[model samples]
Target: MSSNNNSRTLLVIALVAVVVAGTVPATVAGQAERTGGTVVVEEGETVDSLEAFGGTVIVEGTVTGDVSAVAGDVRIEGDVEGNLEAVGGSVTIAGTVQGDVEAAGGSVTITEDGVVGGTTSIGAGTVVVDGTLEGDAEIGAETIQLGESASIAGDLRYGGNLQGNTDAVAGDIEQDSSVGVDLAPTIQPIASWLFAAYALVLNLVLGAALLALFPRFSDGVADRVSSAPARSGLAGLGVLVGVPILLIALAITVIGIPFSIVGAFAFVLVVWIGIVYGRFAIGAWLLSLVGVGSRWLALLVGLVIGAALGLIPIVGGLLNLLVLLLGIGALAVGLYSHWRTARRREREPRRGVGPDGPTTD
Candidate 1:
């Protein structure tokens, strides 16, 4: 079969895999899993789905289902029947996509030979389109370039410094400078307020859940933060500065790619958890000062206050960062302390009276 035919077949297989995986639980039957490596779908090859966590993902065949990559570069030179989603680094499409293309990265580029049958949405530092898009294009970037050969059958909506050839054809061109503007008056005050409210609510919910699941651990983290504020903040600052450097160093080795990916994900998870804990700590402290002691109430109050502060112009960002660092650092210290306690227990001799005599077991 030709490469195109193979690509289509692979795409179908990928879709089937997704459907099957979704309907059937993995515990029932062990499912195939791939992680932390470059994925190359060579010419005439096909895959159910292509997912890469950190390393590069190159497709030269066909993908029946979705193609997704995080903290990695994705290059498509074949065909995708389903959606293409990428985050971080860059995305280059020089093939055919039968579904929508959504990318958030440093840069996104569609070569002249590229073709998209569905909508294209890209959020990046730079976006260059020199291909054919049958559907609408929504682009948010610092810079957007449309080559002369570009042809868009649907509307083009972009926000950024846009430069394109007059010959580039599209259904309509709409430029909205507010598309990528951040922390500016691009959006209405009401919308910004609503967003802040939403974030506050979400954090409160997460904080409540964490407190319910791990009350002792949560309390311990908060206590650590209160006891050693400066130390925790310093630790957090170190992590904030050191993690990216570590990731870069790991990426230098082919064998370390998977580890780098895992570390990156772990770092993000830690930061999120730390932020939640920080808010919880703040709420608890405020409640203590007022002689009220409900964890739930504290979470609610803290989240509200934090969200409101975040709505402030410049000081809000710094305050949030400080909270994040303090939380992360406290959590780290608490873990280390726990580890030490466990080690001490393991090393200490246990005295017990046996049936015959005193013994250590």
Candidate 2:
């Protein structure tokens, strides 16, 4: 087989190794995602926040509230009145701003004309700050470069290597690992909440849509999923850790690998479906909770809740954990139920071979 064909074949075969897609869900999705698209928040664009996943986010107008994203590239050419957070390839500020800027990506740049009233925090491969910082500049990266034009009025503190083209009385500077810009940890309340919000909304919307379009199919899947959520969750989690090991094991063997490979492909397909399915399921419940009994109402409520929850703290974290557990539980239950049902069916005596004997009739 050609290399491409072999790879495609191998890819299909390898999917069987998966077990779970542990939730931290949005981040997991965005970890390898890329974003690309100009998002012009036109004048009078009254947006409370901006969120882009696995794509480019371009702000050419104004955003009045906090902007958070996990994307490919985030370019701000307008103005932000609040905080900016992202996990991306590059963050470029070429406009005016009125808040703190926090970013984790490959590189971050603030143009000479850029204006930041609050702190500028970053985690990247390289950070070139030529803007005016009214507050502190806590640059966390592999290399920090400040042009002569850059002015940071507050304390300069960072763990990464730095070369200041300008000078300041940085209150602290530490090269410790902990000081580096770090992705928010899971157990942290807000961190978990944000994650949950994303998953909940995403899953809910996806689930509702799927269910709505295919009521019977949706019901069947939901029944299965809800019935075995824990098992499914454990299975998903297991897949998270075991898939890689399984793949390695497959690679080690030759004759035993054929079917193992196909299962791997099927596994990936299942996960993608499950994620969408779970999200939609959550969306439906959210709609009902908000007193939106209409189908359309449920969708709008789900999306809105997703966005809002993403902004919340404790509740948001709970939302994430809840959806994850519930979804997994459903899947787990479905499997257990199916197994039990099958076993019961098998154990039942045949009509012709009844326990009392067919001659009784």
Candidate 3:
């Protein structure tokens, strides 16, 4: 397979993935609609941006925004103010599309009544066009047919057998043989290393900032992790498991949805901090054994060693998990201690000698 074929295959796969993603329950923050099963926009009906994923999708009304569908069959016989994108077993257009049309399927067609104002791109097993295309047309298929009424305003580039009324095309007609999947080249290893390097840099910067801004708190967390590794690990495990459960419970309600989202982000940040702290604590402990007390040096040593171990396979992953647990647990324990102390102080009575002897505050 050639590069063009590879590109087409990727496009089709991506289209399928998009449809699958739409099935997940997620709120889009605007005037958009998403649904599964047979979807039909009845005549005289109007909708904003629409996405359908299921057996069949048909539009006979007016769409003021873009329309996208991934189904067994999709047919449009309406007015679309925005682009029309579809991937299915069959796709047909018999309406006025004010924007581009991107379609991939077993069979794709543009009926006589179809009128496109922008470029048209299609990838399918078979393609037929008998409409007005005001822009360029790039098609990849096993078979292509352009009806006598077909009118393309721009160039036509396609793959496979072309048997149609070429005279109706207003621009150049060309054949591209290489329009399928290409299986060559490997870049996963390089990409992995690059990602690791980036992560290391980010962690180093973050660690430096934490040590500088909150020296006492950072030292205390490290001390707790070093002094009570078992306790810290248990706490970390609880947090790792419990946070998700709590978030999910919150997400079950419409009112709690926003809070759940915010909590999720905050949880991620806490986990990252824990990971850094875990490494820093280990470095500090190791340095202490050698009678060293430089916090900066400890941080550098711990992070570098952690990064190196990360390159190993199973051992690296396990070690990283352990550190994350220890660090998070220590942080949690320390916070609980602070909260308790504050509460105790607030409850304690302050005495002042005055005319009423002693006054409690």
Candidate 4:
């Protein structure tokens, strides 16, 4: 496919993913009021910014906070205090931003006068930065067009195999990133290695124990990750954002006692979910090993070998991602399994519940 066609395809996929994953709708196009074919956030508008608006957003106003739009044609003509994350058909930065701009679209542009204090990243066809990117500009695209006025304070990294105009990068060149490296420098390699190794070892031990004493628990966890990603994701997000807020609110009101208690329990559930995911990954690996060799040695040999390989530096990060992906998948599957089992056994139970409303088994 042509580069434009490829970019358009990815853009559509990303738009769908954002909507499904976040599920929060926002009509922020009216931020600066409408004018002509553009939806402008005109000057002198101080606000909470916007989120998930599906229309074109043309901003010429002042935003005190972050602005995020899903599937909007994002055009920034104002100043924003916080970051801007946009997934749209097209993105254009015509003003200034005090923070980063993360955009994914068919095409992106930053005009000569546009200024960004932080990074500006794009995943699309062509990124013409005829503006100033005070921080780095990372792009994954078919071509990068650098105008004569373009300047970047940091390195410019590209995903597609292509060179740029000499004037495209008016900054010092950094190390060229490669696909074989899997963008390891973006994250801590040591941390990834440790996480992968830990996941392998811990899951192996848990899987072996489950196979020996409680095969049902192993089965339960795996089913949850695979079939109940929504619940897991919601549950995970709750642990990260909701729990802390719930606790603070608990201290504020005596009437909110129940909510605080629930938050505490939810925190525990998140940890349990993590454990369940780990064991499931280990179990899958064990099965793979047994399929290839001896069943008796699968429990011990699978973990030792898998984990040992995880400590191998460059390969470890990808291994860690694979383990995590499996664990998350397993959690969904495990949840579904648990739910079906519960419903099967309780077909004729009492309607008005009493501690029987899907208690953690």
Best by TM-score: 1
TM-score of each: 0.53, 0.41, 0.49, 0.39
Candidate 2 per-residue lDDT, tens place, 183-213, comes to: 4232133433444564554445445444444
| Tens-digit lDDT track of model 4 for 1-361 | 5986776566556544433322222224433322122344567766666653434566677777887754437888888888987656678888888899877666778898888899876766556778888997777666667777887887777666445455556566543444213322332243344345545544444445445444556555544544564565555444456657868789579878788877776654445445445435454545654564333354455455556655676786566445444554455445666799899888855555357565332
Instruction: Report every candidate's CA lDDT.
Output: 0.75, 0.60, 0.80, 0.59
Preferred candidate (TM-score higher): 2 or 4: 2
Instruction: Tell me the deviation in Å of residue 276 in model 1.
Output: 0.5
Please say which candidate is ahead in lDDT: 1 or 3. Answer: 3
RMSD of 3: 16.2
Runs of candidate 4 with Cα error greater than 4 angstroms are 1-39, 161-171, 174-361
Off by over 4 Å in 2: 1-38, 43-46, 168-177, 184-361
lDDT of 4: 0.59
Q: Give the TM-score of candidate 1.
A: 0.53
TM-score of 3: 0.49
lDDT of 3 at 327: 92
Clashes of each: 2, 45, 5, 24
Candidate 1 lDDT at 167 equals: 51
Which candidate number maximizes lDDT? 3
| Of 1 and 2, the candidate ranking higher by lDDT | 1
Which regions of candidate 3 fall more than 4 Å away from where they truly are? 1-187, 353-359
